[model samples]
Target: MTNIKSQSWCWIEKGEPEKLILKDQTVRQLEEQEVLIENSYIGLNPVDWKLISSGGANWKKNHIPGVDGAGIVIKTGNKMKHIQLGTRVCYHADLNKNGSFSTHTITNGKNIIYIPEKVSDSTAAAFPCPCLTAWQSFKKVPDVVNKKVLVSGAGGSVGYFLTQLLIDAGAQVYVTSSKKHHQKFLKMGVLNAVDYNLTDWKNVLLQSINHNSFDIIFDTVSGIHATGLMNMISYYGHMVAIQDRVKENTLPAFTTCISLHEIALGAFHTYASDAQIADLMIQGEKLLNDIGNSKFNLRDLNISDFEQLPRHLAELKNNNSEIKYVIKV
Candidate 1:
């Protein structure tokens, strides 16, 4: 294998996006189960900026700070020979490892997903984190057919995917998001789309549902805001939190018999067993193929050049805009 030099955005210190520095470094040799990819697009997420703000214990000086990317494989280690060179692929990088903000990145073979012919590099790059989190959250409660479901924060990426998946699975989906997204959610088969800006939006939604409790509530906006949503769930119903879970003290009495679940996709890298990791890959491939087949719609994307990453990330952190960001490398 040849050593290739890569231009990467490095986290020089603990701070916001402004602290990131552009640097040139040599891509090191891959391990037996790793493959080297030349990145074409890097996807940005809130977690990227959040991690930068609160530097982790595992972080080192000049560490790369991105998680999602789509690229072409240039080389594979001996054990990963089955992944052909030049194959188009996308991956969510392990949080503890140097990531995809570079022109090249090395990733474990099992963590990569082959991009379908119909999917674009930008979509593939942006798919893994939010989409995977949505998929995992969807799996938390299985039987949604004809069930009453609510997706809080439905305008966000994860909420978008979860809303679509639940609707397509035959659930009567309801959502709370900005007024601008209401019509779009309605077009996607949502039963009701409540504008969350209202003072008593939850009451507005309750009236829409005729005061009936939801069978399942997928909360993308968590913390106390999510805890306040507990009363809307039916006894014995399920709640899946994508951001932060409700605290134990905030939960209703055990007689309510509610089930709670939390999604942390990045934790899979450090905590999952080999079999679980393989299953995650399988699920990721299925989601990618579903996108290629037009089973799910892509959101509006804000594409920018590599050099604009820091500026875009800062905007993402401060504005909390609905548009997804993809950096072309």
Candidate 2:
């Protein structure tokens, strides 16, 4: 074991995303039921930038920011049972704690899952946030077999995983992406791909399904187009969104009997019971195990070495690129 008393971590000095600074900080001893992971790669998510953008007194006091990370376990709390030192694992960091931007992070043993041997460290880093969110979102509609489904923001990481899950379950999955990605979605076996940027894209989507309606709608970009897409959903259908806090006209959904779910991934960790946490851990491990044989289009990631993390995050925030950034720490 390393006699590591401190770790190098990125600290948020200001609320501005570009104002993050790299610094060394003392490591804390783990609590019972917690484990320390030496992060090899950290996955970036919109929440990271959103936190820094607030630049409030709370964040200024505790500057560490990150959520997704994959690494080797170097230490375990005495009460921890299954996990051992030297296990390679990945997890979503608790929102209340110091995050995964550090070289070593402490996470609850129940939250950490083993990374599959077939999956690389970078890929493992990318799985926790998006895959876990997708898994929880799909649980909203428990019976998807042979049903019609739609995934907004299909080009995104969460949408990609959600769509794949729906498709593999025999659902007639449709997606909204750029025209360039239409064929890509088709090749992935989605029923149709609509270019959301077009003025009359709704009509195109309606025609693709021959005016049939979707039974489930998973909107990763919130419900920005929900009002317009409401009429396309079948009566009593379910809708799940990651960004439902945004102001949007969703009255039409009620008229058509659509149930809207606002999914916040943090809530799963924050409010879960002991049994629920154990179930989540099991689900996470199963998802990782299956990814090796899945047809998910997970190639060509946007990656940066530890030194370039700030610049990469700034670029990720400033640009409209669809790539998910992963930091090799």
Candidate 3:
């Protein structure tokens, strides 16, 4: 119902940056359930690159690559009564239209969650996927109070937010990351921030929590890399992975013996009842506000060079963690 324009980000096919398929396309006209968003700040999730480069989410056909972002509503469907025009909201993109990577995106109004007046757009961008994952995982298996929860790759955006959520709920959260984020992890309230560099990781964690015992593991990093931590989990302790499910571990029983929850934010979008997700978002917004007022550590975001977006996506795959990148459109 409003004017449309060019989008942000170009997906490449064969070479890293050779193909730009999403280069030309008119945005979708709004349907009754759809609302158009003017993307303010898009949160770069690891999947954005994986789905585009590896064709994991098949963006070659769909084109744009992003899932989470914060923005304002420039237009609303005629039937859309809940969110008014000019409202600020954060959304989990359909993955059909990519996330909010574009200057404009037409999304299902149901997927758009409004941000509180006190929360900044960038902070709202940081909340959706990670916060939803944290809510669903803990909500799925609720009985782990005072139980030790280990969040591997805890320094990442998702892990960082998840750690804060767990801590606020009184769960003993153990975290791991490169030495660089060790101090950063401790400041976020993790019981132990294990640096994968020095000493035996499992031994160090076990030694540190000798009396407490690790009962639940919240893994954001998986595959063979995190086998040692999987081995450290206590009997009947549950392990939920935010990244991918563990196929095999050195301690197969430890991984398989206990409860394993495959926590995917997409599941909520596809399968959750409206009432369930509503409660989560309501709670997520509250937790997001408590985390802090600042968006993320990406205050001095470098968006001047739009040409760097492709390189940024490549770097995201090669590196272990993410570098928060914002491109002003």
lDDT of each: 0.90, 0.78, 0.68
TM-score of each: 0.97, 0.92, 0.85
- Candidate ranking under TM-score, highest first, comes to 1, 2, 3
Error of 2 at 168 (Å): 0.2
Give the per-residue lDDT digits (tens) of candidate 1, residues 131-216: 99998999899799999999999898899988998988899999999998989999989999999999999899999889999999
- The digit string of per-residue lDDT tens for model 3 on 219-296 reads 778644444456566777777766787665445553447666677787666788988767766776666666556533
Cα error, residue 289 of model 2, in Å, equals 0.9
Q: Which ten residues in a row have the lowest lDDT in candidate 3?
A: 296-305
RMSD of each: 1.2, 2.4, 3.3
lDDT of model 2, residue 184: 74
Off by over 4 Å in 2: 1-9, 55-62, 245-255, 295-299
* Cα lDDT over the full model 3: 0.68
Higher lDDT: candidate 1 or 3? 1
- Compared with the true structure, the alpha-carbon lDDT of candidate 1 equals 0.90
